[model samples]
Target: MSNSPKKENLVSIIMPAYNCEKFIKDAINSVIKQTYQSWELIVIDDGSRDNSVGIVKELLNNDDRIRLYINEKNQGVSATRNRAISLAAGDWIAFLDSDDMWERTKLEKQVTFAKKNNAEFLFTGSSYINEDGNYYQGIFDVPKKVTYKKLRTHNVISCSSVLIKKRFFGSIKMEKDDMHEDYAVWLRILRTGVCAYGVNEPLLIYRISRTSKSGNKIKTIKMTYKVFRFIGINPFGSAYFMLKHIMGSLKKYRRIKFIN
Candidate 1:
């Protein structure tokens, strides 16, 4: 908050692109418009048949900070993110999905927040938007810090809102699972005695597509259960946590409905 020039932290942004031709441009432009200028965006195309790659290519011609990698065959989101992470050069890594957008000062403010709190893993509150970019009701309510136990029940961390120290990535790897891979990685990181902190400000916009995994309530629950099992939580424990997650989600949506 001071007038003093803060240390320049180079943030590497990882984006996994699929058939996101409609929203990818807005996502990339959000990075280009960031107030904090030192960032390299690594966008990996997961063999999208659409014009997603072409749109990114056109943007690449305009900005040297954005780079694209092509996976000839379609890989899952986790694999795509892992590839981008391998290519990342910055000491700090942030994630921005192709369908999400960030506020201009997201990185700038989050960097300072992380340093102030001495947090290695950090995420901010985010709001949902329609595919057309219209604001949807009810933003997330994030805690100041979440421990492993807390996160097992409520995972309010949005991937696009995260800015993490790259050192933490050495121990926690995203599983190649089709669902809840990010949640699994976050849990793994927290289990290693690190607490994830939240900035408490809505700094990112998560676009909701009708076809997205989140839109299918049953699939979301099934995938979460699978993630719990994949992470080695006992069957009963997984069910307990999964139920809690569902209840929490329902409460969140209920609040949104009230707001609307």
Candidate 2:
């Protein structure tokens, strides 16, 4: 990976960590291996009780672009991500969860695609992986462009595959205490007339674990209903969207499981 800096278009990567020591190394190394050279990785440790901080520190020694921040006490992912977002000094902000990894050309291709289409918010397709790092089926099949109306009923954006312009950070900060906080933020951005574009190619390895927050199916459905309510949709409208979300989720999971 070339460390040479480019003069323009620096993308800042935001990573929020909890007790993710097992997969943190691959995540950080994925950033280091990116073909795009002009970027900074800001990793916020949310009071991890493991060696997650130590692993990050070791990687920081050689590269000045990767910086680590710490929270004295445990904070939620939204709070940790907001801290990193505040410190981002780039025109574009990309996200990579601590347990997820990216392809080497992920950033390189995204930068070109976003610029080409003049998109403010963008997300790419992602492949799924199990706890053992075993590959699963390609679960994400993103469309060329997603509108606010399209996203109201379903959220197709993945946190790790997002590359958003920094201008929206001022108005749309992530909501704390929300199970689908990332989905809420995307809806908020789209409401402001920003169209979310998708690259339609798998650029991220999204890890699925039984212990993860998203692993609980029942809770996810509950939280998704809450998301629609939080966004101020009426009860009838919320029901319609919630049903759509549930059906889509079931269909997607069934396809993935059958393939495995």
Candidate 3:
């Protein structure tokens, strides 16, 4: 862990997991490696019927700052996140995925930005890392101010890179629907009249592989369609966005498009 100031603030890092055995440790390590020492790592096992839970328990046993919560059955990501929020006692709420990792100075940099800007909510930029450590990143425009209209088209915030005030959770929680739960939750918080700020620098590593949830083309298209629909945007909007996305994917896959 690098040197972050010994601030008395405690940030709750909530994660919802299903079956992320291969990447869970790297995610946990990313949190532990944070230069900021004032964070509690909360791992919610959404009734994972795999070694995911077992491995999380083992890690919790070794680290006092980590807490592992297991559900009796699979409720879903929305429920798991709500429960984690309910159990958290920190002043700030940060989220991370079981399959993602962060840089050692991520929290340090973001917290400093928040304090100086007096930002109640923050969303940072991120880069994609494959299972074997290959990377690709998006360079997004970090607006001086963010609004619902600005975010509807381009979601500058990644779920795993958001850090918000804990009080926001009490007023706004995750939507249980399968379509864009994270996006919906962000909207809910915004409705309460708080603005979200963007950190231009990329600090988190979002991992993807053949086994990842986002690897499925059909499901990705479905979720994208639903996101536009739920936001009260015209259904035809999805057609334009989906086209752009497919073209982007084509460029991303390049020579191996057929195999990918």
The reply for model 3, stretches above 4 Å from the true place, is 1-8, 137-144, 231-260
The whole-model lDDT of each prediction reads: 0.87, 0.87, 0.77
On TM-score, the candidate that comes out on top is 2
User: Residue pairs in steric clash, candidate 3?
Assistant: none
Model with the higher TM-score, candidate 2 or 3: 2
lDDT of 2 by residue, 1-260 (tens): 23545424888999998899999999999999999879999999998989999999999987889999999888898888888999988888999999999999999999999788877788998888888888876467888999989987777899999999888889778885656888888888888887999998889889998987789988888788888888889888888998999888877777565234
Look at candidate 3 and tell me the lDDT of residue 228: 67
Which tens-of-lDDT digit does each residue in 39-133 have in candidate 1? 88999999898999999999989888888999989878888888888898888999999999999999988888877877778899888888787
Candidate 1 vs 3: which has more TM-score: 1
Error of 3 at 47 (Å): 1.9
lDDT of 3 by residue, 1-260 (tens): 22332333788899999988888988998998898778888998987767998888888787788889888988888888999999987888899999989989888888899889899899877667778766754433356567765566555577898998888777667864557688777766776677898887668777767765478878866776677677566878767765665665555445321212
TM-score computed on alpha carbons, candidate 2: 0.95
**Where does the lowest 10-residue lDDT sum fall in candidate 3?**
251-260
Q: Give the winner by lDDT: 1 or 3.
A: 1
Per-prediction TM-score: 0.94, 0.95, 0.83
